[model samples]
Each structure stands twice: as C-alpha cells, then as structure tokens.
Target: MAGSAFFMACAILVLFGFCVEAELVQHTFKVSNMMVRRYCKNKTITVVNGEYPGPTITAHEGDSLAIQVINESPYNISIHWHGIFQRMTPWADGPNYITQCPITPGNSYTYKFNVVGQEGTLWWHAHVSVLRATVYGALIILPRAGVVGYPFPNPHKEETILLGEWWKADVITLQNRALASGSAFNISDAYTINGHLGDLYRCSNKHTHKLEVEQGKSYLLRIINAALNTQFFFKIAGHRLTVVAADASYTSPFSTDTIAIAPGPTIDALLHADSHPSNYYISALTYASSPAIPFDKAASPYASAPPSASPFDNTTTVAVLSYKSSPPSSSPPIMPPLPAFNDTPTAHHFYSNLTALHPNSVPLQIDQRMFVAFGLGLTPCSVNQPLCRGNAISASMNNISFSFPTTVSMLEAHFRKIRGVYTKDFPNRPLVAFDFSNPSVNNQGSFQLTDKGTKVKKLKYNETVEVVLQNTAVLAAENHPLHLHGYNFYVVAQGFGNYNKKEARKNYNLVNPQERNTIAVPVGGWAVIRFRADNPGLWIMHCHLDGHLSLGLAMVFEVGNGPTPSTTVPPPPQDYPTC
Candidate 1:
C-alpha cells in the first residue's frame, strides 16, 4: 500500500564498489529502423545506433554512465543495464512499466547509473515488451584501475561472443500476430553468433563469423547467451575452457569442454589455445529440456544431411575458431561432441561445480524465507484467442500469472500511493501445494491453470531474505535460468526434485557460495539463494525464457526505504514515458 508515483530522476548515487569515483562516461544511442539480410532474406529491424547487434558499452568498475536514448524506431522501447546494480538509481533499472515507462517513438530519455561492486561480463537490452528480440549489447566491466586484477592470469586477448537468435518474420509482426491470438512465444527461425548466421542453413555461408586467435596463448572468451528463448551448449571444436566467472560475479576456476548457459546468463572463460592450429569450429546447439513437443517445426531443408538424434533441434550454428597460422579450408573442421539436447547430468555438473573464489558470509539469521514455485501451464483462453485452441499456454509463480501495469509504472504507482497499479499481496508460499516434481499432479483442477494478477513481494530495507525456487513439472519442465534485477544474490545450494526444506538446509554451504544475478534452476528441481535487501526499489525476479516470461512467470519485490536518504530511491526521470 506504499504508493506515490514519480518522475524526474536525480544523479545522486552513493558509491559502493570502488571507493574512488572516476569521470563519467557518456554515450548517445539512436534507435532507428534498419534493413539487413539474414536467413537468405532482407528484413527491416529495430537497431540501436544503426548496428544490428548494437554497440558495446565498455567501462571499468565504479564508472558512471549516462546514456541518452533517442527512439527513432516506430516501436516504443527502453534499455536495461542487465546485471548491473543500479544502487539508489532504480529509475535507470529499466523494465517496461516496472522502473520507468518506455521511450516511445520520436521520444528520448537518459539512463544514468554507476556500476557498483560488480566487475566482469554483463549486458544491456531493451526492456519494453518484445523489442529485446533484436536490441541487445554487451556491457563489460573490468577491475577498477590499479586496485587488483582478475583471479586468473591475464589472457593474451579477450573476445566477446554474443550468442543470439534470428527470425525471418518481423519480430513486431510475429509477436503481435501471435499475441493477438494468445499464443506468441520465444522460438526463432535460426540462431546467430555475433550477428552472423553461418553455414548451418542454406545461403548463410556469406554471413559466417570466425574468431582468429594465436597459438599457445590464452584468450578470454566472454560468452553471452542473449537468445530470446534458447539456452545453448557452446563449444570449441578442439579445445577446453576454464570458467572463471559468471553473471559478472567471480567464481573459482572450473574447466570444462562445453558450457551450458540460459538466456540472461554470461560466462567468462579462459581458453588455452592448446589444440592444433587447424580451423577449429566454434559451435552452438539448442538446449531444450522441455518434455513437450516444440511449437516450431521448421525442418532442415537439405535432404542430404543426416537426421539428428537430439530432441532440441540438431541444427548447429557455427563459426571458425581459427589460429593465426590456420586459414579457411575446404576440409571440414571437426565438430565438438555436444551432449544431448536434454542432457541434465552435464548441465547439473557445470552448475554445481562452481563456487565463489572469494566467499562471503551468509546471514545466520534470516529475516524472511519463502518457497516460491514456478512453471508453465495453461489458462482459459479469452474470447479473442485463436492461436490457442480454447486453452492458452501460460506460466505462473505460485499459481498466480503476473500481468504488467497499463496506466503507470510500478514506481509511479508506489510513489504516488496510487490505489490499483499493483498489489504487494504476492504469495510467499505456493497457493496450491502438491508434489511439485510430479508431472501428473498438475492434472488436478487447480493445478492445471492459474489465476492472474499484478502482484509483488514487499520487503523491509536491508532485510535478509532466502528463496527456495522449486521448479514444477506442470508442463514440459525445462531448465529455467532465473534472473533478478537490482542486486546479486548468493547461490548457496541447488539440487534436483522437490525441495525438502529441512533436508536441503542441512547441506547448505553457509560459506563460499557464489554470488550471481542469475541462477539456472534445475529442471523439475530447486535452488536456494540468499540476499540482503538493502537497495530500495521495486525489483523483478523472473524466468529468463522469453516464452515463459510472455506467459507470466514473473513477480516483483518492493524493498522499502532505508534509514538514510542515500540508501533510498528517488523519483523517476522527467521525460518518463506515458501509457
């Protein structure tokens, strides 16, 4: 019931990460219409600064950034500095209708925030509706100048590999058309590596991408899974990588042949160029853990190519990881063996092996704890729905499907004490309890579909909170990479199957748990995370799967104001968009 709408963001931020504040970094982003060819077709898309993948924002830790966004595209949009802790500047924590309103066509707004207590690979992407499908860029944060260096040895060089998806159909058209029928989703025609769809599909050879590296030198590859829906198995044909960090937070180095990451996740790995200098293939394969048949059925057009065995389509997106001595060759580069599309063991191993190199103490006394359950399900189709055959696909957290605000942003409503913009009545525990891992249990009347609302969890500032995220098997249970905006939380424990709070708490690593903004909740499993809600703002926690998101698998956390002004979030920007 704490409501007071606001606009006009101020530049005051209490520095947290780096003690010494550096000069402000400024950039101008002009969102405009651009036409480009992909999937053997010329398509017009929304691009930032006229770049397909958009321009990268690079800065060291403790640096403030003021990005002026001029939306020239036809669609309304807002950019989010994903994985960056906005501190007191929640107005810059963009999520359409959550923090600020969208920057409408022909409108402009400036996002001002300082990167605090974070260093490593993060990203920026559109926060409005479905615009993020084509608008995202890397936001790299390096170690503060002269204070320290990476936990691993310095790489000879670093490379950014932005893994994304491509669609022949205009995203706006495809999404709107699908939504109007109540069945829009996150599947794409093809995937891309740094904006190039390689030789996997027909007429794509001309747009292939290749990364050149020197032999016997170590390289840092910042791997970002920016795909709207697809989680991926990323590998190099003949090399192994030592993972050093994830989601911009440092982790103890763990070596692996391939990395499995979901959307909104980033892995910073060190690759030792130890393989033969032949043109090695860098490949990405779809990781679909859902048990349900996919909605997409576009088959491989080439009959000569053998059929694939993996449930997630075996169509691989490729690029050459060429050594300086090796050039392109007709001889087929060896393909790295990828685990099956639903390989749970491999995915679990990669996630569980990670630990915080610099362990922070977890709170011994928890202020609030909740068993939050989430998954895909069905809902009664509206009269207008045609894509769904009377039953629309939906997602929910605790049997409640989240619906965004229409009249004002959550911040606006909360600030102005508006009556109905949102409700802090978000359930702390599952409303209808059942054996969460049993796929058959959801057949019951209440479990088959969920009710909908605009709900949020209210938290007292600086309160310690623990969440046991239990994934349900209501539908095709998939590995969901859950992302929380505003603050990075410590991942203390994760496991498969229904979470037994008493038993699970026994194995909790109160020490040395990795801190991250995103955690991949095991399919039909659970993960436990703890964080101190010191930052005052209305934050979002949701499944990063775009399809799941569209179906309403998300909620908000409204952290109350702190004792002092510096710890409190101020008003929104003056030019904030209106509905």
Candidate 2:
C-alpha cells in the first residue's frame, strides 16, 4: 500500500506539470492583408496573411488566442469570429459598427480573447460588406483540456478545402457595374479550390490545383463553400463521401455520392480514395435555382422561355481530387455514382425528422414571433436626384433598404428596443412581394431613402424568440443563407413551396432540432428558427450570401441593456477608418 501511494503521488505531480506546460502552448497570430498576384496573373487583391482564403489557424478550446489584424489594403477591414461563443467578452465579437470599429488603411488592431466554450469547426471572415471575397480563413478548434477527442472515428489524413468564386474583372469595377445595372452581377468565371482555378482538363501553362492522394486511403475533407451568390453540388469521381459534420456541429455519419452546400455552410466528409484506379476528378457544380426577381411575367425578360436557364448552367471548377500518378489506363475515368434520394436513409431521415444535428433542447416557449420577407425590387429615381443617379435595383428585408442616419447612435439605440418601429414608417413592399400571391402586410408605412434607420427588437438578457423567414421566389431568386451573430438558433422546420402555418406548427423539431448560427432559407420557401437572446450586445443578423447582404438584406438586434449608465460600445481603435 505504501508503494502504490508513492506511485500515485508521482503520477499526480506529472499531470500537474503537463497542465502547466499546456498553458504555454497558446499562440497569437495576426490576420492581415498583403498584396498577392492571384491566379498567377498580375491581378492583385488584399488577402489575409498573404494567402488567399487566408491561413488555417488551429487551436483547442480553452486555449488563449491573440489575433492582430493589420489593414495593409487601401480599404477598411474587420474580421468576425463566426460561431464563437465569446461569453461576456463582446469586444472580441468583431462587429464593424456594433463592436470596435474597422481597421483603417495602414492601421492595425489586436483582438485578444480566450477560446472559451465548445470545440468545433469554425471560420473567420471580413465583417464589412463584400470584403469577405478576399479576406477569409478557417479556424479549427479542438477539444478542451483533459477532454476526450471527437465522438466519431478520426481519419488518418485531413485537408482543408476552401471553395470560393473567382472573377476575372476587377472587384471594384465589377461591384460598381452591378450597382449601376441593378441586376445579377458578375457570374464568376470559375470556382476555386483553395485558390487555384483548375482550368478544367485544359491545364495550360497556369499552375492547376491537383490533390495528390495515396490509393485506397481514407481522408477527411473539411469543405467550406464561400461563394458569393451560388449553391454547389459537390462530388468526386469514383469515391463515396460520408458526411459526418456540418456548420461546426457533428452529425451521424451518412454516405452520399453528392452533397449540396451554399455559401457560409461548412461540411465535413470522409472519402475512401481506395479504388482500383488511382486518380480522379472531384467536381463541384453550382445548383442553379431561379434568379431573384418578382413572380410576374413583366418582371423578367426571359420569363417566356419554354425552359429557363438553370443557375447551374455556368459552373466554376473548384478543384480536382487526384491520386499520385499511376499506370496508364485504357478505360475512361469512372464518375462517382449519383445519390438516389429514396435510397439514402439519411436523406429520408433528415427530411422526415426535420431536425438539425446539434439540437437545442432548451425548453422555453417563444415570447415574441416576427415574420420577415426577403426579396429584390426596383425604386424609381426621383427627378433631379443627386443620390439616386438612376433607378436603383435593391434588396430589402421586411421591405426596407438600409440607410445610415446622421444621428446614427441615437437611432440605433431606439431601434434596439422597438419592434415595428420602422414597419409603419417604411412601407413600400418591393415589386417581388406584390408578385407573390396573397402578400400579407402586417404594417403599412414608408420611409425616405435618406433616412438611415435600423429595425430593432428589444429583449431582456435571456428571452426566447422565434423568427420565421418567408422567401418570395418571385423574380426567380436563389436561396439565401441567413446568419445571425452572437447566438445560435434552432432550425425548427424547413420545406419547399409555401410555409403552411398549421403544418409547421405540427412539424416543429422542438426536441432535436439542429442548432446553428447560420441556415439556408430555401428559394420559394420558408425557414423557422428559435433562439434565446442571452448575449447582451448589438448583434447584426444578415444573409450569409454576401451579395444579398450588400444589397441590403440585413438588420440589427439589440439585446438586454447597456452598461448601467451608458451601454454604448467603446470607441473603435485609434487607427479605425470612417469609411
């Protein structure tokens, strides 16, 4: 007994020493912009840490993290830690206007915060509008100290596949043209895998991305779809992909030959590259839905076509999943088997159950319910208008285009606590809304273009709220991936066609609904979400589809009260830019 006790004491001492050593492992990384020649071409854009899609920063939960963002670009920039539970540290939440301001050109800001809370696959991106195109990266969080690894089986090899859209035109010029045209902007020439546009099989003098893998080896693929305004159906030739995780949450491993993902959605899949043939092409094609427009015939010029063009007609080649060079083969490359919706039990289970993998099991009734409609419309230019140079094609959430008021702070404070504050004042539901059948108007009012006001709902520190988003597929718009900052919500129900209130009420996944910070609002359909307003701060909720948000599909929510006497966030860092 005496000898055993001595051994135990030594083991405890060693464990304590290990804990002390772990503390020293915390890392501080600076995510900033540096000019890089993209596509091996002279075209330059500000990128994070000098790399497109930035660098992958990995750390375990509970580890200390210090990230300094220096804006070397000419534009103002800000980085938001997506899906991170910052607890009381709202300062590190990274809202451009709500939190500390953006980093100005030639300035730097260091964001210091501990990686508290759960461990999962998360990402970081620019908070400012449209800048995410160049400024984004992956942030993978491991388990906390003393905790076991993930519940599922771990793979031998892992790679991060960041999917993005690439445009040949200058980004600023493209944006300006789109704003002027008030129509679908630059359709990306190619989709990129990590940053390389595998110019199809026609690999010219340009460096094409080819993933070299050993034959018959299982590899984990962390896929992030960062497209601006498209959803993609991804599949690799001659291999089956087993999806095990999505949006930073673990799901039961389910096999699928092809999986569809939208912008802001991250999916983890295990690929068994063990095949007779060594090399294969991993293809990802856009799943084109109807363009965003009104349902009326007059809204679109191509509405009369017998068969309209599917959004997938144009595809961006992301990357090629290839094995090391093998013996020459006479047979053609084998394409991956297409997934049958009926055969896959997981698909049936997912739809029948209508629940998310990360269920929010909180038992709280919703105290308030809000209905929001997202669509695109046109506003006629007023005569002799200085701001309205011409007719403005715009997007709106609840029938309001975003405007920045001169008395921004006071208006922000008022909108933070009032529901329906702007509804009656800013009425003009867009043309798309009228094109949709049986358009419902809860409030009727109109606000001027000069009014820069926000719609806000006041909630206590911990209030349960439900938001129902109805997408009027008028004008044939694509789906929108809605994202909320600060809180994760339960996707209670989702489906095609219109949202039947009676059916939705019966099919609510209150028990095992997946909790997520972002969700895809299907085209011509509806999505219902429930969330607890626990985090006290001003949080922005917007479409993860960067294009839509830039056009004005976003709003802010102020939760709880401010600091006792004054609740406003501290002034931005000295180097922050007004632009």
Candidate 3:
C-alpha cells in the first residue's frame, strides 16, 4: 500500500524512462452482501472485501494496478476507475457493456491499468446498475518517484474523507418496483463521512466518525463525494480550507470558506489547522437541487428539500475534528454556514476560480467543435407497458437516447470487426434550438421525445475536440456532472443561460485552465471543455449523476487508430468477459 522509493537498480530505457520499474499494486476485492445497520435498522448491503468503503488501493504514478475482483454478490458487477485516463489500455476501463461485459455472478475479472500520469485522489466504483450504493473504494495515486513533488508544501498529515449515502432498502429491489411504477424513487435516509453516519442519526451516536488532529499543524483532506445523486457543501466550523487540487489534477491554490463538491469530483484541500484547541464540526450537507425549477414530487421526494429541512434533516451527519489536549464532551458541535439550496452563483464561483498549476501541454487549436444539448425527455410507451403508464421519462444527449448493446461490449465489437453493435453517427450539434434557460419553455413541441439508439462520435487520433454542453430545461433543469471515460479535459468556460459561442470563445481560458475528468455543467447553463482524442478506444461519456446515467444521458467517443502501433489500441486481455 506504499510507493516504493526511487532507486537505480531496475531503471529501464524502453519507455523514455518515464516509467521506471515500480511495484505493482495487487489487491483482491470480494464483493458480497452483508447485513449492516443504518438509521437504527439492520439491512443487507453489498460491500467490497467486507468493508463498506472497501480498501483504498494505493500506488505511485507509473505503477500498474492488478485488482482481482471476485463477485460473491447476486448482481453482475464491473469496476470503473472514476478519474483514471485509461490511455492505451481501454479494455481495463470498466463500464458494463461498454468497455467490457459485466463480471457475472460467482465469476471474476482482473482489472489491470497503469497509472501513468495521474496523481492525487481518485476512486473506484461498481459501474453496473444501482449496485454502487455500497460497492466503492478510493484509488489514491501518489506522485511518481523523482519526477514531481506536490506543488504546495507537504502537509503534516493526510486523511481520506469519503462522503457517501446510506439507504436502508436495496436499490435493485427499488429499481424493479420503480419499473413497475414509473418514477417512484427513494433517497438514502442519512449521509456518511468515511463509513459512519455520525452521531446525528438515530442509534448512530455510539459510533461516529471522528478525527483527532494536532493543533496548529496543517493537514491535507482528500474529500470525495460518493453520494450517488447529491452534491454536497462541506465545511468545518472553525477552519478554512486552502484548495489545492480537484479530480486528481493539481490546481493553483485558492481559499474558500465552504466548498461545493459534485457527486463525482474529488477535492484535495489543505486545512491550516489554526483553529482554537477545541473540537470542530466536520459537516456535509446536501446540494440536492436548483430551486429555480419547480420540484417534481411525482418522480421522487429526494428533491423536496435539502436534508437539513426534511424530516430526516436531523440525520445530518457530523464528524468531530478534535484538537490535541482539548476537552472531550458529549455535546453537539457547532455547524458552519451552508449554501442555500439554490445558490448557483456560489457553486459557479468555486468551480470557475480553479486553474491548473501549469500550462496545459495540449494545443488549444480546435479540430472539432461539438454542441450537444442534454436533459430529461419522454418517449411514448408501447402498448400497455407498465413502466410507461403515460410516457416513459428518459434522458438524452443531442436528442438521441443511448441504448445499451446487450450482444457485446463496444470495445470488443470495434476490435473484432463486428458490425451493428453501434454506429459512428452521433450528432455533433443538437437537433433543436430554443431559449434553453427558459424554465417555462414548452418541451412538448420539439425536444420532448427523442430517438433511442447506440450512437457515437468518431474522432481521429490527436484531434483536439471542443464540446459545448448546454443543459436543457425540459423536465428538470439540474446540474449534470458529466464524466469522460478515457481522457481529462480542460473546463475553459461556463456561464448561466444559453451559451453565446462568440462570447464564450472570447472568455475561454486558453492557458493553465483547470483539468478534470468530470465537470458539473450548471443547470440551465453551458460549459465548454476541450480534450485531445489521443487515446484509441470506445470511450463512454455520461452524466455521473447515477439516475441521469440510468435514464441514458450518455454518448460514446469512437477514436480512430493512429499510424503507429504504440498509439493503436492493444488486443484485449484473455480474461475479458464475453456476453
């Protein structure tokens, strides 16, 4: 679980010395169902290697990971490295039926990928269905040996803070029922820090997640928002966080009082630890929805209110950060200020202010420009379908809903010369145009129902592509955190309302823009991101909000082969799952 020290014994010249011989990380994850109590009730939940947050896989940059995943649970499973750019090894990029088929019940799959250029906080999670509710773990990659230290000074200590949601009932059971009764959903009763739901929840006061820290010593907090559908506002009552990195990429330091974290992006913030020698409250509250749009009570009660105002708002989890030599008391700690349920400006400012520590190496010249509008839509139901009592609510990108191919994986179909699995004809521009930010705009005319198909955009190697993602106000105008599979992109510009291309182009950050694998395109707003299509594979891009992803807010990037073998995709491994 530690990075091997730099030495001169096994250095090789094969790969330009960027990759010296480093110890490979080997771990076995046994996915099984276990009974656990949350909110004072015992319920069976899926777990990885018996741990709720599983085991944190630790390795240095340039080291490869060999994770043997053994499935003992009833559900089919696939693990996705959330922020890892799979680079040349797209086969290991786990998206069920995308990169590979699921590792079926009682079966196993070994995911092997090199952490070539990534560092800082990233994570791994089950990519199949709602099973990610309990099956996920942190994948922390340290800096490469003899290459780069952290841009900021090293902290006195580092701690991993995993933010998660805890549901009493199984999500699969709920999904089946939701299929029978369209749009009925339930959110977790409580939120969790690390693995405990803190003392605020019913019967959880005995075992709260707490941290004992030395006074006046700075510590780095690697905070991950693993809550399935809720982005969070995290803060400590008496401390300030100096933001350093997001999504495993280094950022120019900026200080913020309260940090808004989306579901998929990880934050690495430096806590100066300059507070009085007393216990401080570590609080995470729900950044659930934008209050501008009317709530959809018929769909789910999750959007009814922030957790603080709901009946279970008392379930607000709180972990204590105790200063050394401070007196211990069985009392509720003070809470910090949380953003209003609909503070888009605060959320926008937090994301907009971050920049990369260094200038980007990719050229800023745009080779391809794509404008894809995404949102929830409705498709007319076939005869007497229960799931579509009226119209089946769905999600889409560019007026096309992505359908999963059950026959084979996208990578296998592309590599083995199979046809009809997917088409490389995804639209570069949206099918309809309107005042996208107008909440009162009618969706019944142009963009209400969308065509469903398996489609992708084709890109050549090394082509720099810029995509302007505009969020539509069709059903619900909510923040969609888009996660790109195989590459990290620079989020150059984002703004409220419809995007003005000329104005957006003028304001784009061409130098030292913050790089991230996931970007939260604001509700009724637009975000422009640029990435080079250098990786050869069928990469899946989708909304990280699990519900939106299930509803088909996704697309694929089919990257063409390069002239050289190194740039071309390698053959699939022997253990790759077949349908």
Candidate 1 overall lDDT versus native = 0.83
Candidate 2 per-residue C-alpha lDDT over 125-178 given as tens digits, one digit per residue, 9 for 90 to 100: 887656777677888877665645666666778888877777666676677665
Q: Against the hidden true structure, what lDDT does model 2 obtain?
A: 0.62
Error of 1 at 123 (Å): 0.1
lDDT (10s digit) by residue, model 1, range 184-297? 453577888999988878899888888888889999999998888888989998899999999998888998997989899899999999888888889998877666522212
> Pick by TM-score: which candidate is best?
3
Candidate 3 overall Cα lDDT vs. reference?
Answer: 0.82
Local error of candidate 1 at 367, Å? Answer: 0.5
TM-scores for all candidates: the values are: 0.92, 0.80, 0.93
RMSD of each: 8.0, 6.0, 4.6
List, residue by residue over 149-230, the lDDT tens digit for candidate 3.
7889889999999998887777888766654544524667788998888887778886588888887788999999887888
Query: How accurate locally, in lDDT, is each candidate?
Result: 0.83, 0.62, 0.82
Clashes of each: 17, 18, 0
